[model samples]
Target: MSTFYDCLLTGTFVFPLLGSLVLALSYGRLSERASATVGVASIGLAALCTLWVGFAFVDQGKAAQTLTLWHWISVGDFQPTVGLMLDGLSMTMLGVITGVGFFIHLFAAWYMRGEEGITRFFCHMNLFVFSMILLVLGDNLLLLYFGWEGVGLCSYLLIGYYYRTPANGWAAFKAFVITRTGDVFLAIGMFLLFTQLGSLNIQTLLARAPEWWSDGGLMPQLTALMLLGGAVGKSAQLPLQTWLADAMAGPTPVSALIHAATMVTAGVYLIARMNGIFLMAPDVLLLVGIVGAVTLVIAGFAALAQTDIKRVLAYSTMSQIGYMFLALGIGAFDAAIFHLMIHAFFKALLFLSAGSVIVCTHHEQDMRKLGGLWKKLPLTYAGFVVGGAALAALPLVTAGFYSKDAILVSALVSGHDVLMLAGLLGALLTSVYTMRLILGTFHGAPKSDHAREAEAGKGLVHGLPLIVLIVMSTAIGAQIHPPLDEVLPPSVHGEGFGVDLVEGVAMIVAVGGVLFALWLFTRQRGLVRRAVADPRGARLWQFWHNAWGFDALYDWLFVRPYRELVRVNRGDWINTICNVAPWLARLSHDGLRRTQTGRLRHYAFSMVLGSTLLLLFLLVG
Candidate 1:
């Protein structure tokens, strides 16, 4: 029998590429349903192949597995192979990418059912799945980069899927520009790694990293920081996070797939994959932790003030990724990955449920105008509760309790007292805002006419993913310790009861946050409204709501300054440089024009003068 690993090595990557080709050849001949079916099946097959490979690797007790198909590029001493590397880290990422990805493709089939460019939508989706697989499976930095840039291209296409909307197009452009800035640093880091280590292979890099560290090389720290820069931009951490809130302008499924499950988590995966490098540079890891902690708190506060349904979820996603980064920074790599996995489940559930809400509500996202939806869409409300519980890290009710609490515990035990406190506060804020979102959107009186007519749809398409995710979310926390430790390295600190403590405290904080939210939004509505409307209260709300104006500061410091420099330099240096060729052409033309007089006398005189000048110069010399 051919095992799943065999199929993964041969089938997963090829299936999507082949399916995409088949769809392209079929082109407009195929109906929308047929095209959507083909796209979904391709990714479905890829997911199966990923699962198979995961089981095979786990069964064989292999820490890492690599399969090389062909030599992609070779120049002098440089060589990069197109290959797949499956490890604990990449395997987890593969599962999320393919599994959640397949579901999103399914959801899109229905979401984009009547849209004009259905075929193009499927095409972009298949390409996205292919790029994500390559990203997770690549054995070297260069191949990974190919997948990285591929996903970026797909993101640009999908975010502007409705290119007619100038806002959507601008949002897509913003995502592209911001992420590309991070990519520049990532590229430089890869170049440095290759120059210093002479290899981009993951195993080889890890094996040689210690030697460089012992020799007092700066490459390790510099490379790690550069990679963090890329992660920050991609994951929407702190300073680079503003674009994600705006990215909700894209299709909801795009938001669920790229922002939630796959693309944003790429940064967390990169950090975990290169944990050995970070381990060698403890200072860099500390910086990662600090930045992550700050992002978590700031984004949590931002989520608290959002009225748009998707933007609220977007901020929550940012805040959640910050927790993963916090774990990574504190040397809790496994915890970070654990939280990432659990986050994929709930975040996808939340986004999809939100999509269904938006679909039924006729695209109205403002919570102020959305109320009393629990009766209209009970299943969606149920999904939201389950997902929100997970988001709040509410004890044993969901997967978040296990993964997120473990992170807080790890922080506390690692003696990062400040980080631990910040994480707890973030957790509280998460509970508050998420519950606020639920109560405001689902539990109150119908604030808008749309909700009065809102009706729940069949649960098969939308509810199935939520159900699957809920089960995974519930089961993930219990599966954390001994089983995970077999593949993952032990926690930085020796094992302790941090998990138990975290769970208990998480329950208390989550309930408190929920109670606080109810008090603020439901019980004390007039006060809340007054606070939002008053200048003093509005100022504080606006500050938190605008992500503490990090975006504005980045614009002033980075975006505005760069644009100004371009304008000034364009007017001065570039204008002069651009004019130089034309100026030279005109000079040559003028010199030649002197010889082009329409008179034989002038021509002869010019020739004699030239000869005399040549002779005089020669004689003088």
Candidate 2:
């Protein structure tokens, strides 16, 4: 039993559960103000405890620390322990989940003011924090899975927080169904690993994978691919990407926390957490890299055509996560995690700031209708600019520049030149769409009557969280590469691939993207209008606007076929069986009804005939 175990059980895991109990007990009895305060305080304490664990692990100078709580399951030789692991990687994730979680809670308190289900909202939020911590801190696959499902449940509840709206329900269902697809693959991958290695303990499996499957074998590749399926599904990669955009039907805070900062990033976290398994199968890594690059390009283009403010950010989240996947796919696990951390800070800030804007605008999300918001909501506009800079990877202006740029650079050094180029193009596209979003919503003249009244509130409820995120986003770049190396096993850093040239090109692309968006939306609106009027240009715009019709293709390939099979079977077998049962029941009922008619003579005659037949049969026998 390591000292880390004691700290985790005593602090990290226990406190949130306790807090949740308190909140649950106080529900309805306490005032809304009190409940919100308690919710924030609980998560705030959890964040502090997580930070303590991070520091303690760093001070101990250990690569990883595991504490076994109990035997989760035992099936003869198959045993999996329920426990926690405090390592450089888990610590990094824990800090982000708890810390950003605290700010999001604070932001939600104000954003959700006077809304129904406020207590329920706090309950779900606390549970989400607990689940996310479990995800990062778990020592084995089983415990990790418990948290995985927990988050899925929380996401569904929160996405449908406004259950009155049919669209919200649909959004929740879509997200659930899509993520469940990934969870299936995750389960299969875990089973394959355990069947092959006979253990689900992450440390043991990682250490033994090389010895057990060192012949460059198929099982490892198959498992890696299966795991990638889960990552793709959870992270909202291609084919599974549509649900995330629709998930914006939920509250804006839910969008900020789940879709942007925490939940959607789980897939990337899963791959990084199991870097050893992926490292063994370079073929799998290459495939992951390709999928990531493709998703990045496609999602960036999708963002370019979106009209809703949250949808644009949703697609941007997918694209940013794709970059992280590309990093992991190229064996830059640390860089991927680093980028994930930095992306969380800025993306959460963007979503939260967007939430404030949406709230003040009376929930009108069409970017085309919003303009000159910068004047009315200067603080939000400032936050938006910082977030946009981060998302665009604009030079040395933000942490995103350092982390995202590093991923592309790492890919080049690892011999994936095509991916590196695609990644760069994706970055450029990210900038174009993000700037389009900022300018269309806040820069141009107000296209709607509501914009003039939109303003940031004077309360600390909104400003304080944005201020904290701004500070963190500015300083986060310096924190990524150092302390991580001390507590986690150092990742395989590739040779620098022409740092100056790559940096120069990335900066140029990012700047060009921003400039182009500004020019098109501001100075060259006439050009955009002319292009949209032309048939050929309109087709191109439409294609991008509909997410390249990936959803349609999926429907044709998977949904239509499945529904057709059901239709055929319903008519051929199911309907036949159902008809027969009902028809036979009707006949039996009619015959019985006939016998029940008021006819005493018929009854007596039938009784006499029955007695005669019985007597004759007995005599013959």
Candidate 3:
């Protein structure tokens, strides 16, 4: 039985990796259908294996298990194993990665049809799945970081899949550099753990952390703060969040995979996985809550001003992740994971549905050019409604309400009143922007020729994934919960505010925001136009539209200064010093060329002369 469990767990990640290898090797040789089949089938098989493992884990009562495949490193007291762990937390991540990833892969078949480099696309996608799986399942920090860096590499490749486009390449580069900054912080934190606690094995380090830092001093605080820095960058929280809106340069499937199932959620997983270390550093944890609150509100406002459909969703992804971070900050780890799972469903649905609309409109993604799509694309329209409602946390019907309400209630019970109010404000902003997105894309008359001639996607490949996701974005999917009580800290539940009052207030705020957006966009659009026409309103819109000028601020602070330094020193003494080795190599090559005469006589003379000199020198010695 143990062997069977081990094989299932191993195969869950291996299948996708194997598929990636086969697709990568067979690039340009395989048919499009063959590539798609391999990509989808690999994740499909992974999903099946995950289901088997998940059911077994739950049925057996959420017992934590570990399988050390082999030793990774051994140097005296420092040894970390190549290990895999199966527990409630990993189980939840497995289900999200494989299950949502499978549907995204399936939908990509239809979305990417007739596009160039189909095999390469599938190769990157499969590799991404494998990396995220390793990240969640690895038992040691070293193995987890291996997967973490692998994910960054795959994200770069996948984001710049359209390599001919310079803008996409830059976007990929930005994401790579920004995320690596965080990875460095994470590496430093790991080094501190190994130096202080003497283990890189996660469970061991976590067990030993309390013994070493039970007093909540500087060392634990510094380590936790460093880990939070890594999380902030990877999760697209404040300051590091400028990369994500540009990340929409990737294909829609890549966005769905990254935003919903894999990359953005990695930080949440890290914090939750290392809850023990964080508990000792109370100040850092509070900072985590502040970061989430600030990021969510900022992202929500930025989302409101987006003209591009995908960009709106991109900012929405950031804001939603902020909610997860908020849950983590307030010690509601289970609520955070629950929301992560729920967000995976609805966000994937939203992205794929948006992809469908993009395809139907001949690649037109500007919401300004889209309208009256509901009648023409009923299935896609239904997907957006359900997915958007879930995103907005619409009352009792959507999965998001249950999960997000859990976070909010946890906040109130934990006595973080300001953060709770920030969450509420974020919820209001979420509803308003989500409604505006829906209305701007589907409600009004056709705004351009693309919308007028838009063709709804056809066949099962297009419809099946959306249908499945729509179901998962509802209350029905909310019923299926991760058995996380044993894995994470239990959610904070007490008597600060009546749970009913909180729910009712949250419900009203959410519905009111949607209604307010409806009236503004639908009934009083002229007033909206007039407001934008005003200079002050226009300036405010532009400010929010540019994501509060973060990109520009970063450009001024880092990019411009670095470029200026390079320009000034382009031909300085440093360049001369750097060129010395190359100059010597060139001189030696010229001298050697003179001796390499293209004649047998010259070669023979040189060899004989060299041999005589060698013999003379040896005799003298």
Candidate 4:
């Protein structure tokens, strides 16, 4: 017998999965409208299922439950189960994955209406949801890794959906290969945990982790660092952080899904879910904060130099994820996940609206070539503003402010003043880049004749999800009480002036950054344009524009060396030896050719010589 919650939990991932199967099976059989309807309906059902399960879980007192389905593997004393788990953490992740995922799917339905192979696009997107659900719901590390690898595969496929372009394929491969490095680390960490403690069951692992290893033990630190490696790759943290920006070659919907709701969030979820293990390695945890803080600053400035609209959002995504990492590092687990949720809304909103703008402007993404779109697409413009405000963490109004303030305060409380200051600086940079993004497209004079007024009848469908996201982004902070409070670390302070002062300073810095961007890019464009055109500013521009030359550095270091090795071993040295064996046989046959040149004479002479030798031996004997 199963509870109603069980049914809903199973159906959450299943609904979209079934939808994906339907799309994949029908292939060319279904009409565009039918495919779109199925695509949207399937995800909508999944979202509904998530809502129902979440309600039941909450109503039942949010008591964590691990529902095991069956024995997954057995090797005499070692077995892991395959099942779903529900708690504050998984539920929050579920809501965001399916909820925001639903809207993104719907938005894509409209955004990708006219394209050939639209069914395939929806199919991949649905599959992504299913994979992500499995990831968040799985009750054990192995199952989570299954979902982990699943999304990576789907990401590669979706990112390279436009397979005609070589660049798209390359981008997809780059994402796949780079993230695989992190996966290797994750696998090693999993192996380490299992061999050390003999169980990977989430409850068992979490329960026994601290007992099995001392806080400063070598094995615990190594395991924690290895897991961090995987998280860094998946979440696109520093060093492994370069792949995410290039992932913008994907469709706007794919970008939104990958950046906002699914792939990037997995890393944050990983650390938060395994907080016990991390707590054993405080230095590693502190390193997490450092990585996050550094990445946020890097990404913020990188966003400033981006020319492509999606790239700006792409870098912004990296920077935001960095904030989550910082939070996790400082033991602000709940705040990290909380920010993860709010970021999903606002970031998805921005990407979706960016899609609308791109579609209306005839696929124009370069902001310098885009201008005066606020009047052209007022709804999209409004959604962009909402998302931008949240992204910029605009004081008390936006959701980002609420969540980000939590992180900054947590940093300070955790005795990470340097990290706290870095975060504030990143927030300021966030404000600047976000304003630059908004004004560059909406305020400047029309840069191209392609920009035109959007038709409500046709364009309104695309804006549907944007509106929902806008509302969520603006209002979600109000309801962020116990739902977000349960899974994270306890607050470092009660309601006090200290919290208020931190909030106030964050607000002022945020506002200052936005004002500065507005002044420079709009009112003072004439004055600053010349400076940017000057040698020093030009150098700065190139540095940020090229993502601080990380890509070039990687190419020179890893890519070129690998390519050179491939060239050197192009024939495969082992295979070359095999090639020589055949060549020698041919050479020996050629050497024997002369012996057989005159067949009759050669044969007769050989026989006579053999007979004569035999006779001589017989006579001597």
Ranking according to lDDT, highest score first = 3, 4, 2, 1
TM-score of every model versus the real structure = 0.90, 0.90, 0.97, 0.91
lDDT tens digits, residue span 76-177, model 1: 878889878876777778778888888877777766767887777788878877887888789998888888898888888888999998999999999999
lDDT, candidates in the order shown: 0.83, 0.84, 0.93, 0.88
Best by lDDT: 3
Report the lDDT of model 2 for residue 236: 89
lDDT of 4 at 148: 97
Clashing pairs in 1: none
Model 2 scores a C-alpha lDDT of 0.84
Backbone Cα, N, C clashes tallied per candidate: 0, 0, 0, 1
Q: How many backbone overlaps does candidate 2 show?
A: 0
Task: Show model 3 residue runs off by greater than 4 Å.
Answer: 495-497, 568-575, 594-601, 615-621
- Candidate 1: deviation at residue 128, Å? 1.3
RMSD in angstroms between candidate 1 and the native structure over all alpha carbons: 6.0
Candidate 3 is scored at a TM of: 0.97
